[model samples]
Target: MRRYGPAVLLLLTGAAVLRISLFGDLYLRYVQAGLRPYLIVSGCALVLLAVVSAIISRRPYDDGCQGHRHGPGVAWLLTLPALALLFFPPPALGSYSAEREAAARAAQGVGTFPALPKAKVLDLTLAEFGSRAIYDSGRSLKGRTVRLTGFVTRDDDGTWYVTRLLISCCAADASTSKVEIRGVEAPPTDTWVAVTGTWHPEGRLGTDEAWPAVLDAGDVRTVPEPANPYEKR
Candidate 1:
């Protein structure tokens, strides 16, 4: 049994990876969409290696080494993650994660933002709204009714923000962007919602401060978390 430990560890780890990538939302929590192919390939390769190792372990060996060989004890640690992935896969990042990191802001002198879309009500992402509100000198958001969606967060001062995580690669590298919501009661923390409002233009611009751009919310309603929770940069 000890001689086959490495093979067992590989098999379990590979299956866990494949199970998460193929059958669940686990991949989205840790990686970007473009990485799915590589994950799948890696899972398959690990499983294949496990099979080869198992076969080799079962074969006859010379010098009385067949049953005496033992895998390094450290290899058993790999099973812990495999078991966790199978039984307790983690949820997507939420208000706790948002609270841990400082809010992201548009960089100074990011250059001119393009014109806002011509529409009665424009739908904008949290990151895009932050960029325009902070860095766009054109004030494209003035007098525009726009829609934004994100989870709710409340500050110690009783202020509320509609917050979303922006991920360039994965959750490990995720940063948050938010709009300070006014004129509506804040929903429970981490509750997803869509807010329709106009930009208030009172917040500072062109800095990386944690201050959220202000929005005067006309309407607020709870909604299901989207299939893809993190907004990609």
Candidate 2:
């Protein structure tokens, strides 16, 4: 068994990766959708390598690793976490992740944004709303009723935010975008909600003070968490 330990570990880890990436959207919890092909390929490669290693290890060997000492067999224990992905993948990033990270991503610069559609209400992503609310020179969000959805996060002083994470590639590199929701009762942390409101402006445009934009919520309701819960940066 010791001789095959490394191969078994590799195979199990590879199976777990395939279980998440090859068969379903679960990989989205950890990485962007565009990277799915790479993940699937990697999982297949790992499984193939494990099979090859096992086959080679079982071959008749006169020397049987004659000179090289095997590393500690305890290395198999590292597979525990990897294998867990097969049965119970971790939840997507939520309120705690939003609060723990510095939520203020620097704006590229203050600029005039494109005009809003001539509609009574607009559906917007948290990042889009946050950027316009903070950095748009035209005050595009002013007087416009918009609906936004995100998970809930709160501050100690009872302030709460509708928070979402934006990732350039994956969860590890995610940055936060939050809007403080006004005129609504606080919900449990991590609960997903759709908040419809007008922009509640605070600081001057394109300034640090404008960070964590505010919303004057008109209506708030609980919603199902999205399957792909993250926004792309």
Candidate 3:
């Protein structure tokens, strides 16, 4: 068990890297900020455990450690928090996202929106789209089908929302925009997906529409996260 600790740490490090690449700053956006500190602490603990384990094994340098073997239980102490995280992750992708989405709607004004072209893709950041949608509300999106892509973020209602985080400087100043998409949809967490639909106001505050503004959507397909995930929206 001690011998495998280093291998396990390496595997976890690889997994963390993969998750960061796939989700971009998703972990920071959705998960609590405190988690970053926890991750750092856990990493240090794992590294320390590996060093101690290596010293015990002493296979490569058997000078001082003639016959020292660490107990298997030592590994468990280092693994407790990590296992807990795997078994029960923090509550993320909930009310916080909805609150931010609503806040975005409030900030949008009449001047920000532009007349969208037909049969075309709207290449705007989540924040830009959100601002425009709020500003124009029902008028701009009605009867016009547009396509947008981003990561899936969940709201408090358990209804999956299509969202993208827009950044001006970096992840620290990032903002998000969301749309409640229905019809052609499935779960696509932490994955890039393209949705096509005509805007239909859901009749919420600020906008004369319901939660979902896009309707009769077509070609909702999953794709990869772009290299520059953040856009000036």
**Residue by residue across 106-196, what tens digits does model 3's lDDT show?**
4334553566666556554555455555566346655555777777766557666577665554455556667767676556466678777
Q: What is the lDDT for 145 in model 1?
A: 97
Q: Write the per-residue lDDT of candidate 1 for residues 129-156, one digit (tens) a residue.
A: 9888887788889899999999998889
What C-alpha lDDT, on a 0 to 100 scale, does residue 43 get in candidate 2? 91
Per-candidate local distance difference test: 0.84, 0.87, 0.55
Q: For candidate 2, report its TM-score.
A: 0.92
Summarize candidate 2's per-residue lDDT along 1-233 as a digit string, tens digits: 66677788789889988998988889999999999998988899889999998998787546657433355767778778877888889999887788787645566798899999989899999989988988898999999999999999999999999998989999999878889999989889999999999999988887778888999998999999887999999
Clashing pairs in 2: none
RMSD to native for every prediction?
2.6, 1.9, 8.3
Candidate 1: give the clashing pairs: none
Candidate 3 segments whose C-alpha is farther than 4 A from its true place: 1-105, 118-124, 204-216
The predicted structure with the larger TM-score, 1 or 3, is: 1
Worst 10 residues of 2 by lDDT: 60-69
Which run of 10 residues does model 1 get worst, by summed lDDT? 102-111
Over 4 Å off, model 2: 61-71, 103-107
Ranking of all predicted structures according to TM-score, beginning with the best and ending with the worst = 2, 1, 3
